[model samples]
Target: MALLALVLLAQVPPAQADPPISQPAGPHAVGLRVIQPAAPREAGLPAQVLIWYPADTSVSDAPPLRYGDLMATRLSALRTDLSATQLREGRAQQQASLMRRLGVSGQAVLDAPLQARSQAVPAPGRFPLVVYAAGVGGPADENADLFEYLASHGYVVVSSVGMGADGREVEETLAHVEPQVATLQALIRQAPQWTAADPQRVAVMGWSWGGMSNLFAAARDPQIGAIISLDGTREPALTRQIDVQRLTAPWLYVSRSPDTIAQIQRSGIDTTFSLLNAAQYAEVTQLIVYPMQHADFVSRRMREASDAGYGEYSRAEVRQAFGMVALYVRHFLDAHLRQQASSLEFLARKPVANGAVPHSLRIDIRPPAKP
Candidate 1:
């Protein structure tokens, strides 16, 4: 599969190419913390949850959180046979690839004190919580760049490792999805203890399988106020299970290109039914990124994959589309979770009017159906 090919290529060293990644434009610096829930529902897999939050600007000088380190750790855990030398080489290759593609060393600082905890003054009001769900068998930090970007923008972002009931690759069935949903609920319940997260104003963001799982979590837990799916929510069987009436949360669905959709159809998979189409009672905003494929929605894959991974799109074009995805995600959260008037207006305008590259994406906004 293309995903397997990208993973294999990420382990190989790439030629140095400094294509700039759109850095987080938020004012606050980013801080990260990994918390092991006292009572995790899925005990079989690593239950450590990653929390990214706004941090004091002074901590920006702290050492950058190496993406390679995170990738290497997850890899070593999965493949116990790799030697120390092999692991080190893998780490180096991962970092080198990131540097080549993203043009940045790293964007986040590890365990830097939260803005509230660092200051002696009164704590600021809590930030909205965004629970991130990774793709099947993906790590908690699967979309590290997005987490950091959201954190910098003052949202408390949280994610856990994605695995099935067997503690391995997640399957697309209720039996497997139940554990993922449970993990999300557990994280939501523990948000207050972990950071300055406002549980009442919670949003669930997922990619691929995680995208579908977040819908399940939101359907079960009414506390979720918004949902963001990155090339997710397209699964027919999973979408059929969600009660759209219960999924009243405003949704932001970022999808792959039309060509990719056609390609899926060519493979004999039905591409007609979609959760986004079914949930008409709820407000929905969909952005079709013309350059991105299913895997490109995940920043790790976007940055590490070989040039061919982007298909006919240029690296710069794909990177631009990815950056636009982050911007839209931020505004969507701001509009629904923070109730910011500017963000609401931003979402209402055309993609070009909102500064997105022309022809790079298509946006459609559907207001909630009148009662």
Candidate 2:
């Protein structure tokens, strides 16, 4: 039966995958570049930082960014135990799956010239800076789509490789948190030097473990004007330790569907305590996306996963939800960092009012506690 299943899987023809994520609604063209910061060798920071910012050049003829290459390299490192024949077969299968899932092309053009550098000389104004923190031990570009979208919409997005204190697999402890926080602070400090980033309007966005790290960064650095978390900061063990008084930035927490009582009990998660609840000092907006699991928060994972990966939700539905996530992040940044009345009003409305599918999301907004 196993052999027959394998044969059937191989014979299945690839269907047309979903289209690339929609072009952002921003007026500016997008550009991507990598910067290598000069830090003392013993400081233990990432060697390269990826920056996506509004560009002046046309991307019409530029080659689409190839995310598959990065995925393939990561996969190869993890599959060293496979025999040569098995490895080849696995690669072939992966290629086929990718064709059927989403094509490997990402939205950004590689090393595209900065908006200021291009010949099309636009107005001279600094854009808000957003420092992205990837999941623990994840690559810097794990949320490439979100970064690209934000860049197009007039923000300078910066990120570095997510690593632990020992520079290996990140464990869930304060030790692991220290390095990630340091990296985010370093990126914030370097954003202005590398690009036209507004130091006063900085935001930190994180996924999973990086999400928790951003909270720590905000607690220590008041300059982080806003916070965005993707299905992050649910760990009771970790959230209990955050100094919520210092975490006064307006926060947007996008979470997955709530766990059932039985599931919560089974996992030993304390349902009574929550970081969001504890954060009475900041204006908080909680968006619960029903179609997404924890892994689905990362656009790259959503694009790469198989049909089973989405579970009950169709690929189209999940894709739409992912797009909605991007939109919410943009609006949140705009509302807080840019102080745009339109975006602030957009966020003030319910998801349905903002054009989200009915019943797809549950949103709760909490105004900051009166001091």
TM-score of every model versus the real structure: 0.81, 0.81
Task: Tell me the tens digit of each residue's lDDT in model 2 across 1-371.
Answer: 99999889755533212422453447777666656556523444477777778776444443344454334434433223467787667656766665555443222211122222222222257899999998976777678778878877899898877888766788888888888899888788877987889999999999999888999999999999999999885778888888998889999999988889899889888777788989999999999999888888886675455666668787777777878888889999999998999998988889988778899987889999976
Off by over 4 Å in 1: 1-24, 39-46, 59-62, 72-124, 260-265
Prediction 1 global C-alpha lDDT: 0.74
Q: Which candidate ranks first by TM-score, i.e. highest? A: 2
Candidate 2, residue 268: the lDDT equals: 84
**lDDT over C-alpha atoms for residue 62 of model 1:** 48
Instruction: Give per-residue CA lDDT, model 1, range 216-326, as digits (tens).
Output: 998879899999999884668778888988878898889988665667778776666777778977898889988888888876665455565656887778788888899
Lowest summed lDDT across 10 adjacent residues in model 1 is found at 105-114
TM-score of candidate 2 versus the correct structure, residues matched by position: 0.81
Query: Which residue pairs clash within candidate 1?
Result: none
